[model samples]
Target chain A: MSESNEEKKDEIQLIFGDKRLDGRRFDELRNIKIEAGILKRADGSCYLEMGKNIVVAAVYGPREVHPRHLQNPSKAVIRYRYNMAPFSVEERKRPGPDRRSVEISKVSREALEAVIMKELFPRSGIDIFVEVLQADAGSRTACLNAASVALVDAGVPMKGMITSVAVAKADGVMVLDPMKEEDNYGEADIPFAFLIRGGKIESIALLQMDGRVTKDELREAFKLAKKGAMEIYKLQKEAIMKKYISESVENG
Target chain B: MRPIVLPGDLVATNPKVAGFGTYVENGKVYSKILGLLDKTETSVRIIPLKGRYIPSVGDVVIGIVREVSANGWNVDIYSPYQAFLPLSENPEFKPNKKPNEVLSIGDAIIAKVLNIDPKMKVTLTMKDKVCRSIRFGRIVFINPARVPRVIGKKGSMVKLLKSELGIQIIVGQNGLIWISGDRKKVSIGEEAIYVIEEEAHTDGLTDRITEFIKRRKSDVGIE
Candidate 1:
């Protein structure tokens, strides 16, 4: 069963990676689509779709902090959770939060908090929940991008938008926004976040590479990541603006 | 034509100064200055203004009756506002008709926004075509703000969800969703709802949803 499952996965990869069949470039990302303001129970929510990866994120509050221990008097707290559903991937993930997810949640919160003005909400905390409905290569990056858009849609103030992209070394060649196939068999995967306005790297969360790349290759990867981040930024801006325009019309 | 401000463009009245202009608001490529239409000490209204489907007086909305009263039904508008659909609003509602017969708890209906009083009371009427009863579907709740997202860009998302899952999905602007299909389709519909709810905070959500459906379809085959 395991062997056959592996073979099935391989077959799936071959089908998905048939760029000639799909007419896509190696470095090009799958079609990116975004929808903002998607959760009713939450303050802000958004849905992000990138190829075969589906991620939804909800932002609840700059409201009062719960349990007290997590609260900070000097600044607002930011809580982030990155979770994958049991059936999100081909191999089902366990329901409860895992160590890797928890770690990713912490790093993601830190990265996002750097862009948010915690001083504005003092003592309050913003809770961000990201749910992965499907998994491809760069779920984390997708989550970050979606969370930023949701925050903006919720009218949360920030210095600038936070956008992320993944760079990986696949088949001994560096690629931008590597797909599921590239990520499974690829050597390196680096997901980095950037501030949209100034185009500065805000944080690098998960950087793993089976093999080392030259200094020039690393720089080139960073450059590609930045480019991808900008594109994501454009999509985020468009989503927010679309909401605003429609909202204004409704108000009128 | 005035310079169109793309979604992320930074524009100021004075070209020489940097970082002073109003940031372009959502979905608008360019907004003309066209002189200020109205100005207050703290707020101003500009031209080429955009529109949204916010709840307003007389607007029709789909709602679920969450609670029932002798005189009226309490409707969950799926918005920031709650609505009361009075018995008088239902023309066909016989006095002898049990509230369940007219509209039961969890029954979805189209309701018209009658009056949103200063006290925040939302009065609704079931006197419109869209205000009639909804049949054979499950009601789902979403964030009011995310309604557009679920609908997608020009109705693409809803279309895709309906086609892929083979479900009839009706999305109310107030965040109420009614979905009907076969058992498998209904389960898929529920999963799609959760998908929308979970990923509502992200951009590029449609691609993810499509990918999710595709992956899930393959998974079921594998099982």
Candidate 2:
């Protein structure tokens, strides 16, 4: 029996007896902490930590646009940049916007643009910067989470709030909030962002997939990711309220 | 009063009208910003907690002259849009005279927002009795959203500050407050204004500020 157990330990064993390598259920998410309005100079800002990933986002504008020609005549334009710190990863990553970051920045900006009331600030621009201070996995989703909170903190009017999460498949089982190791060895990764209103998801603002999965597997992953996102949405709301509520309580 | 509301929170059901900081969707009024909820008999409004100043007609603002154009002066009102103070709106305007002679760059003036067109072009005028250029005074900056609180209900808070401190105060809608008095008195007034800005959301703010100012005056031997 001991010999059989030793043989079962494969080269990369990500699960054991219905539990992921980290002893989390397939549907369970990693620990998350979010704080809003952390930066003073930025119009709005947020600091977020999900699992081992740490991200900070800041928002500026609804202010005058530069270059004189980029101003949108009827609505505000969004300028988004997603960056990773040089010391964030194990292998020292180079500074500045790479191709992957550029693509992520474009998609993330579009996702937030769907919910913002851009027409309110015509001939102006709103800039959002997301900086990843640490990288585990699902950093794009983490960046989106921080950006949404920062927008609200800046008091930029919006049609609704947004929440995001990632689904990972390791050892043929879909999981929520995948760690760095799982992402490296996982079979598939799917990240999603949902527009939330009235305590319900109004629609999907973003959806991107990597690697291959069966149709049924994708549907199952969507369900798991939505459930995880709702939990994150509650935390996001709480983080924003905490700032004002604590002050009121101190004085009231 | 209800709890503070975030964007997309349902504020009222079947409201007849939605006021500022709120919007109507599908016959329901929803808050559009993070703010305190306010409901009237017929409509709903959300008082925004923080935001940049958006120019509206009739609002008196304190602006700095950034450029002296041919026909008008470009004024930085500390808003997203730059305002134009035309030479025609100047009470001292003369025919064929350069605009810079009237008000050169770097001069600060108190003007009224005369017009905001469809494209958000803000126009300012200095023809009102209260409008004038500031030569010397201290300008205190605070969040624009808290300006109403600083003025208090029906200008009572401002009245208290003015009488207690014996200072001339001009509260701008754009959050630039002009205070002029003896050096020590102006500093005390600036401190009091910052206190009001910080505690704007609290109850009985007027009484607390009164006590604070009195204490500060005695501590500094203002008599």
Candidate 3:
């Protein structure tokens, strides 16, 4: 028997049988690649790719804070700018800091500030620039990941690294790392950034959500996101360490 | 070789005092930077592999005079903080002489960090015997964190380079190495310093540097 017209019309098959539209399981994440110390001019730099999202982060300072007035007597201020290239999206995004970019920049700065030992460099500033050359669904999370790696690569003191990922509900099914199309049509999207210490989540640096999910569904999504973050954290470490390891080999 | 550690890695447990580049938390010591874990008898520290120079009292740094004010000179030590060389602290200060006469803009001086206030104002002085102005030399820059390795154990690596290349080198705490000698030897010295900076973490660096100098001399058909 065929389903009713109303039910058939409302149902979108984001999940085909057991696999998602991209032939991935609900718990699968997009392929991620991270590299550190790519920019010689920057104090530290990282280049990362998550699915179709490409992010590059450059860190400068614990240096003097300019404009004089921005100097904080008790701690260094983090100046973060999140920018998307004009050609990043399907339609050319306008250049400069749009409302969404400014908000993301602020939140990402605050997220990194939680782990950074800013008090060590009082009256100074740390400038972090995350540029998205390609944008997909979870560009914000990807930016945070790259920024943290760059900060560490710069040898900035921090209590821990920040790992970020998103979990979404597509077609009534919870999925990890929603792709672009799924994010556009997803029922709920929740992104999280965690500071892990001693193999445990020491704190949640960022938490944001769009759309709706049940209380139980939110908890499940957080667990799923944490798993994805842990995996990404390992990659971040590998990327940072690879710089030194390769140098040793090549020079030897 | 010591194990490489990242930020948040547990470096030591209780009873081991946390030293530089590390912090103590809940009776355990953890690294606060990306570096190599250094464990001593009574303390655990992390030697950072790369970073900007942080000024402290007693560090001899190579600073370029950026501005010459009436009372003092503003020096750029390549650190985040702006360093000042007061006229009185410059050993050559005379009541009748102006600060610019003693050290004008663009002069490079080897000075000691006299003091660093809580606000990060670095005060430098040319009062020490080793402090002087650079008249002629080439400065090679490296990561400040690798300064200790270039210095080696009690000046052994420096001695090797000096004796082998027949060049004069002054390793700055701020990572600006000054090399002065025959033009060819000076350039070779600069390259050797970079090799040391690049492979700072590895062992037997002294031997490798000696071999490198030999190879370079032969390649250039110099002694």
Candidate 4:
């Protein structure tokens, strides 16, 4: 390799190594902002700005599933396409489904399906499309959280509010809502989603760790995830109510 | 201390009693102990937790047409369902002419919900006075949930956006917005919409929007 190429690789590795960010303690989540019902064309849509990461989601359906093969007889099928726009990252991601996108899409669909009352629309499907405008480390979790809020914004009947958080092991400590830097050098990573109303874990998408944790460490991680989810739930509720009440006034 | 339970979860019979405990069943972790409800229960009733717009009958939704149909136009309602505006609903409309002349495919319009079928087919009518085409203004899209914050407590937000920008603005719950006035005022109105969308969850949004308008007005030397 050329000296310049070697230097670039070294720089990338250095940024991902042994450096804590701006004294942000482990288990601390960056500030999150969510706006629901942002798209006029989709049935329900939301925009999520989490620190520097931006994600937009549009939900459609509970309508007829087009392909005869994917149709389910008993309950509504949940289909999700978690995509990153070509301009979303430092290097543009190639458009279309790659392995990472497909995996994230599958896990996200499972997470959301846990809270959605699929029985409500038997023989149909709810289509959720998440478009990442900007991506840092925890895009998957952000997409999950944004898609849940968008689903609610669309008024799709879900059993409860679904919120997701990412936990990572940094310097042998578990932190909730790890930022982009923390994720790269982290020893282990776990992303989880829960139903806000009952606190039931709807899904656990990522659980890769270089080192094993004690049972207590895992429990603490779960606690932190729940706390983060609760905070997101408040924002989601506020966004929904603010729209509903104002629209009511306009109609009145 | 006893564990707190959120609504809409099931609890197990011999549930492990601990705060923030997780139980494994069929390869899934039930995060809260309370979610392990009795399996034999006849009906599991999860509360309808409020989050955002739930499409209902008679809702006035503002949308853009994505496609046209012989019977009606297929409008994107920004919901899980697509709305159909039948030509019959537009008594004055004549078919075979340019859809744009009567109702262009991309034209933003506000219409009322006539029926929501079991199939999630949304039927809309544009016969109402407010349901007609939006003209002499620019339409903006915002999160439907932020409409209240944009409008303020009692028409305060809307009133403020209008007076400060010197424009006429109408907000639709379906996330369609129309702003009409001077060019500068129209741009200011659009900025206000952006601010509302960005900072809707934050407190003091009204002040923020007002300040934005003031900054734009002063920047334009209109004081």
Candidate 5:
């Protein structure tokens, strides 16, 4: 099991100067686009494209809390469903929520709860559904971005938005926003989500470790992930603003 | 259509009063929401164009009865929390009758927000004519954010839909729309509401919507 990753790592270090498969720099990321309010029926919706990964997210509720017992008497309960389409990857994924999907959904819900004012709505549920339509890697991070956009579009009063990025260690190199190949061969894969607070991030909403890593590597990865997430965050905000503020203003 | 600002983006660089959506950080005022920057000589704020309905005191909302309790009824007001309608608030309410008898589950009523407690429990009063039961017509839901567009500048767009098409419409602030009329005309009204929902972000939408409605009505062989 470990031998294959080691072999792939050696070959990666020997051939690629930058440790990225598509000739991107170690810190470089793929193109990102976020479209707000795309779904016609959903209360709030967003479509986010990151590199080769496309994720669509929709938000409904603050509506009725179904399954009467799940209702929280003091705050709005958040529910999340993260799914990958059957054709989202190389192998056709099965059509239901698997263990991985369930875990991501739970984690994403917790991360989002930090930004939302749950106390404002009592005994209700706000549901977030994020579907990964296409995946190359970093589906969870893409899902997080799309979900945050959808929440804002739904007009959920959030303290601030959350943005995420994946950082990996390929051999001795620290990389940001790793693609599929880098993720498989990397020594460590850490995904980080930061809460945008007071115009700066002072806290982490979600953190996960997938492989073996040391202390220094974790620190460097955290620093790099923060930088990467900020870049993505700026674009997300711009996309939302453009959707609401700009006119096609082209008819001069 | 003003300048946009994001969370942590600098909204005020000089000495100024920070308003609702701004917080001072390291000598500069930063926005807390992805909002439009509203600047004045003495004060500045960022008005968020996005978000769900946060019920405040005195807001009129369309509520659907979700649960009936012993003393009052639980109402879904399109907020994350439910609102409570106690028998005491409605002076005309008959107390001995069961809650369902007064307001059945799934009944829609217009109510004034009486109070929002510290825990966010909402109290509603069905004392206004607008807060009465929605007896007839179909309800259409749209994004709460797009309501201003549906209502139009000075109630122009909706009034146009009502007068021209001859339909009764109630524009609920909570994103509930009650459209009442015969089937043919109600269908036309429903289409118009969807049209508004779809292209609400575009500028000069009032004229575009009016033109579309006229063409649609003509196509259907109705004046």
Candidate 6:
């Protein structure tokens, strides 16, 4: 084997010391923590942490759309943005949206378009801002998850909460919730989001893939991703209710 | 505590009329958003916990004048779009002076929402009101969501404060509160309002506020 190839193999091995890194089973997801209503200025806001990834999302509007031309006469428009902090990654990322972030932002809006009740407010806009403070592997998924919670927190009418999880094929096994190490060395990575209602997948909001996998592996990956996303769906509800219900009971 | 319902939660059926924040489908009433379920004798609706103020006709709002134009004065009503207050609509407004002379930027006004255009431009009117401008009084801003509770059912909470403290209070639907009257009473009114805003969602809040005002009235010796 070439020397660099040998070194890369060793590094991958070191990162995944056990059969699975972080002592998690291949299908196990990382610990997720979610908090809503963290920002006083924002209409609604949430802070989300998934393993090492940290993201905050704020929702504004369903208010008037500025720049009058962007106004949709029949439905509210979405101004969705995804931004990464300079210190979010291993190497400091630039503070603004890059190619990856732009793509994520576009897809994130598209994903939200499915969840938000656009017909309710015509000629208005709902702006969602997702700011990543720290990034591990599934930062995009984490942001999507956090933004969904923020949308709910902002009291935007929706069909259901959206949850996202990444599935990857590492070695010969398909795994759920890939961390940074697995993300870099995995054979194939599939990130998908589901709008969940009552333990059922209402719809797939986002589906994106990188690398190669068999058709069978693709289906299995989606199944695993859906299962992982369901867990996140529960967490999202818990986070919202933790803020909403408690405030009512304690203060109302 | 009212049971909270999320979007798509089955709330009721044909017997119960679906109200605001709820929709009916296939003989079932489902919540279209996340909020506390409030049921009345003939209807069921959900009261949202947090959100931007979606302007509607007849909502009394507090607005800041943002721009004075030849036709109308543009006001920021704490909503996404700027609400337009026409100089023609205000009975007291005089075209005899420039728009700025009538209402300048940074001046607050207690106005009512006259109409909302399909384009989402809110048209405000200050006509037919005893007080037009919020002059020489303190305006306290709170979450618009809590405004309804602060006023209480049928304005009982606000009425109690007004009678007890002998103050002029205007509660705006957009979460802007105008307090006036005697100088000492205004301060006491402000504190009582702050208390109401803080504990808007608390149970027995009206009684608690009454007790608070009673204590404050005793301390301040306001007759």
lDDT of 5 by residue, A1-252 (tens): 233334442355411655466788877878998899899778779999999999999999777688989988888899999999999999899999999999999998999998877776787789999999999878999999999988877766676789999998876678899888778766778999998755578689999988877788788999899889989988888778777665323110
lDDT of 3 by residue, B7-43 (tens): 9988788736789898888887888999877787788
**What's the ranking of the predictions by lDDT, best on top?**
2, 3, 6, 5, 4, 1
lDDT of 6: 0.83
DockQ values per model: 0.02, 0.56, 0.56, 0.09, 0.30, 0.52
Candidate 4 on B25-73: residue-level lDDT in tens?
4533233211112232332222122223446777777788888766778
Give the fraction of true interface contacts kept by model 5.
0.33
Best by lDDT: 2
Better of 3 and 6 by TM-score: 3
Please give the lDDT score at residue A133 for candidate 6.
92
Candidate 6 lDDT at A109 equals 89
The CA lDDT at A145 in model 6 is 95
Provide TM-scores for the models: 0.52, 0.95, 0.95, 0.53, 0.76, 0.92
- The local lDDT score (0 to 100) that residue B69 gets in candidate 6 is 83
| After superposition, candidate 1 runs with Cα above 4 Å error | A1-23, A198-211, A247-252, B1-223
Q: Which docking category, incorrect, acceptable, medium or high, applies to candidate 3?
A: medium
Instruction: Estimate, for each residue in A69-96, the C-alpha lDDT of model 2 and write its tens digit.
Output: 9998899999999999999999999999
Cα lDDT, all candidates:
0.68, 0.89, 0.88, 0.68, 0.81, 0.83
Tens digits of per-residue lDDT for model 1, B1-223: 1222321233333332322113333422211211112333443333222111336797657887899888889987754345798898897699878766788898878778988765346899878765678877687866554566678779898999988877887777677777887766767767876787655545567888888887876766522
Ten contiguous residues with the weakest lDDT in model 4 chain B: B31-40
Q: How well is candidate 6 docked (DockQ)?
A: 0.52
TM-score of 2: 0.95
